[model samples]
Target: MIEVKQLTKRYGGTTAVKDLTFTVDPGQVTGFLGPNGSGKSTTLRMILGLHEPTSGTVTVEGRPFRSRPRGLRHVGSLLDAQEVHGGRSAVAHLSALARSNRIPRRRVDEVLERVGLAEVAGRRIGGFSLGMKQRLGIAAALLGDAPVLLFDEPLNGLDPEGVKWVRDLFRGLAAEGRTVFVSSHLMSEMEHTADQLIVIGRGELIAAESLEEFSARGTRQSVMVGTPDTEILRDLLAAEGAAVRADGRLLTVTGLSAARVGEIALVHRVPLHHLSTRSGSLEEAFMELTADSVQYLAGEPR
Candidate 1:
């Protein structure tokens, strides 16, 4: 488990992270999410001891990271896949990291194969594709067989297949009782990949909850109905306290179910053409939940 308490960071007069506190539990994939420049990267840097926090503390298990250089054996992280030496082969890089930390040499081959990089073990890092680089990064993170893993945009340059592969890897890790924390800007990816979410905005915590809880209480549902007499149906639905909007050949209605809509069309002598129900999507919920915290909003009225 990773615990952060009252963590804050400042650069001169500007605050980057403010009294942030959250815990990442094991056996679940926790998504660290925020808009651009919202201090998500800064917080991760602090956790890794790359940047000293202006105040507060972060601990893995119960020990400070710096106090325990071997602590990484329990908490593996992949912040940048391209940070490796360009001259080294994939196997060489992992072997060097393990040698430096006194990790066994055999573990290098194990993780390489685990992340599907064993086929390219002899290839130089400079010649590897972005997807291959990502795989190598995962191998490095798993070299110590860590129970807690942190990934920052692991799918950044991956194709559709690579994206799916990373998603499955994360899920598989969490299923094995490991703590998986990932930070990404892609809402679609997070929607399907994460079991829990830790959202931050403007250097403050926005929410820390399950995805189900984040999207559970929606006030409106999207309902689509097709009918030749859309106008008559719209009037009937509106009179029944439902908001109705007509779009081309279909009528969009809220506050009414497909069964009720069919009965309304039948009783009103309007022919029912089609009916479908759409619950709000995770993308919609994310936007609504983080609108105020978005640092940049495009096409704003000037």
Candidate 2:
């Protein structure tokens, strides 16, 4: 597991992260979410010991990452897929990492094949597309077979198939009791992949909870009701303090449950064609929760 407690970082007069505390447990994929300039990259850097915290602590498996000699054996990370040398072949690049970490040379081939890069193992990275580079980066992360892995935007340039492959890979890794922490902007993907979430905004911790719990924080719950007596039901529901929006025979209601709507409709003898509850999505929850934390705002278009 990875533990961060009261972690803070400052560059000159600017504070990037402040008193951030969260634990990424094993046996599940934990998603790291934040808006742009929210210090997500900074926090990831600190966790990998690439940046020193001005105060507080972050540790993997009860110790700082820097304290580990062969770091890749314990923590593997892919901060930037584009940071690799473009002149080297995929195999040669991974081979160097394996040698530095005292990992077996054969492990390079295994990771390459696992990431679907074995066919292009001899190709120079400069010739690879962004998606292929992403695959190669994932291969490097898996080279050491580390217990803990951190990925920043691993799905940045992946196609639909590659995205699904990555999702399955992370799940498989978690099933093996490895700590999988992913940082990405794709809420739909996180909704399907992550078991838990660590949400931050403006360098401050907003939430660190299960995906369900975080999603429940959104206040946009509504019940969809289709009825011929829309006007009558709308009036009746309005009397009960429910906010209702109507489109012909359909009524979208907030501030009430589907069961309550059904009961009200039945008591009023209102004919109903359909009734269903619509819970807020992860993207909706993120937008509502992080509204104030957004650094750049675009004006509404004309």
TM-score winner: 2
Q: 1-302, model 2: which lDDT tens digit per residue? A: 99999999999999999999999999999999999999999999999999999999999999999999998899989999999999999999999999999999999999999999899999999999999999999998888899999999999899999999999999999999999999999999999999999999999999999999999986589999999999999999999999999998999999999999999999989999999999988999999999999987779553
**Candidate 2 weakest ten by summed lDDT:** 293-302
TM-scores of all candidate predictions against the true structure: 0.89, 0.91
Give one digit per residue, the lDDT tens place, for model 1 in 180-282: 9999988889988999988888899988899877765523577899998888889999999898889977998988988899888889789877899977766
Cα lDDT over the full model 1: 0.87
Structural RMSD, model 1: 2.6
Alpha-carbon shift of residue 30 in model 1 (angstroms): 0.6
For every candidate, C-alpha RMSD to the true structure in Å: 2.6, 2.6
Question: How does model 1 score by TM-score?
Answer: 0.89
Error of 2 at 131 (Å): 1.2
